[model samples]
Target: MSEPHAGSCRCGLISAEASRAPFWTSYCHCRDCRKQTGAPVMAFVGFRDEDLTWHGEPRSWRAGGVERRFCGYCGSQIGYSDDRLPGEIYLALGFMDEPERYPPALHAFEARRLPFLHIADDLPRYSGFSVER
Candidate 1:
């Protein structure tokens, strides 16, 4: 059976479920990503817009040419969507119930990676957007 995947915000007030698997997953090291996640890097999984469902209202704002969504109650980031990539929704890996199941296959915005941060894995690295690089 295809076990569905689930996730929630820090306060558990914002929850979501994915009926199908994601299309791609990656670790992003861009300055915007770091600032949004408040981490050295941000991990995300991309799913078709139709495959995911949300349980609560999320506040959103435009940043770096994309719409960033987060839980209004807990200030937890929920996901992001780019106008250029229609039909796709990217979600935070940390919020996933089983984040390990969606290991990042590549690192995006490698050029922006912090000088002090280093990812030990040898996964493919892209200087910019993985899909474009």
Candidate 2:
């Protein structure tokens, strides 16, 4: 088996590893993401929920229909789970040990995207949500 990609929270109370590389990387520009991240966009990596293992139990909160998890000590946003996307997990890119390794392949919620943030990269951009190529 290949080496897993490891990550941890700021306080070291929460850590995680993925058996495989991320299935997808994306930048979300929705209002909810911006408010949560306190940034113009929020970066995330998608993987099978079962593929991710945590070293410690994380604190969870419900936002809409999703369960957002974070380190209770450091308040680092770690990841999230949603019943709408069974068998999959969404990890906050900021929590990655090597965040630069995961470049966003797509931009979502562009309709509500902040006007001050300019993304010059050539990755595909979408107005809202999308589930297909």
The lDDT leader among the candidates is 1
lDDT (0-100) at residue 33 of candidate 2?
A: 75
**Can you write out model 1's per-residue Cα lDDT over 38-130, one digit (the tens) per residue?**
999999999988998888888999965799999888899888999889889899998888999999999999999999997899999988999
Model 1 lDDT vs. the true structure? 0.90
TM-score of each: 0.94, 0.93
Model 1 lDDT, residue 125, Cα = 93
Q: Where does candidate 2 stray beyond 4 Å?
A: none
User: Cα RMSD to native, each candidate?
Assistant: 1.4, 1.7
- Relative to the unseen true structure, what is the C-alpha lDDT of residue 3 in candidate 1, on a scale of 0 to 100? 93
List, residue by residue over 1-133, the lDDT tens digit for candidate 2: 3766878899999998998999989999988777777778999998887888879999999976878888989999887777788888788999898998899999998888878889899888899874342
Q: Local error of candidate 1 at 52, Å?
A: 0.7
